[model samples]
Target: MSASLAPECNEVKERYDSCFLKWYSEKFLRGTARSDECDPLFKQYEQCLSKALKAKGIDNMLKEAREDNRENDAEHMRPKR
Candidate 1:
């Protein structure tokens, strides 16, 4: 649940986390399915995380890991000859 590469953006991340908890309990658990309640906070958190990831040089690493995961998935799904 933590984001922004750890210590950075902790406050905004916590704010988003709180909103998520409220939304989860009030909407999701209540079977309302309302999704927009925490979107703004998530956007803010994501924006901050994007910057932090770029600053910490982790974005490219994550992209490469995702690519590797995709390759692994493809390999696992290969049809038998």
Candidate 2:
């Protein structure tokens, strides 16, 4: 079965996407000036993303999902309640 079709793989993919979105929002997306302050967090995010994608070989798909999440976050700050 494809990685996306596996429950565990799908969950890891979702978690990675969420991690990237949260990092992007806090570091770049939000109208804040870029600074070294967020570098550590970004590094951690990159590590996590790498690990997740390595497990499933779906880095490109995860990246696209992260972009979509960012756009959605920009449109609506708080996730639906």
Q: Best candidate per lDDT, number?
A: 1
TM-scores for every predicted model:
0.68, 0.32
Give the per-residue lDDT digits (tens) of candidate 2, residues 1-81. 123444444545555566556666786677664554545555655565577676777877878899879967787896777
Looking at candidate 1, the ten consecutive residues that score lowest on lDDT are 1-10
- Runs of candidate 2 with Cα error greater than 4 angstroms are 1-34, 60-81
User: Model 1 RMSD to the real structure?
Assistant: 5.8
Provide the global lDDT of candidate 2 against the true structure: 0.63
The segments of candidate 1 whose C-alpha lies over 4 angstroms from its true place after superposition are 1-8, 70-81
**CA shift at 42, candidate 2, in angstroms?**
1.2
Global lDDT of each model? 0.83, 0.63
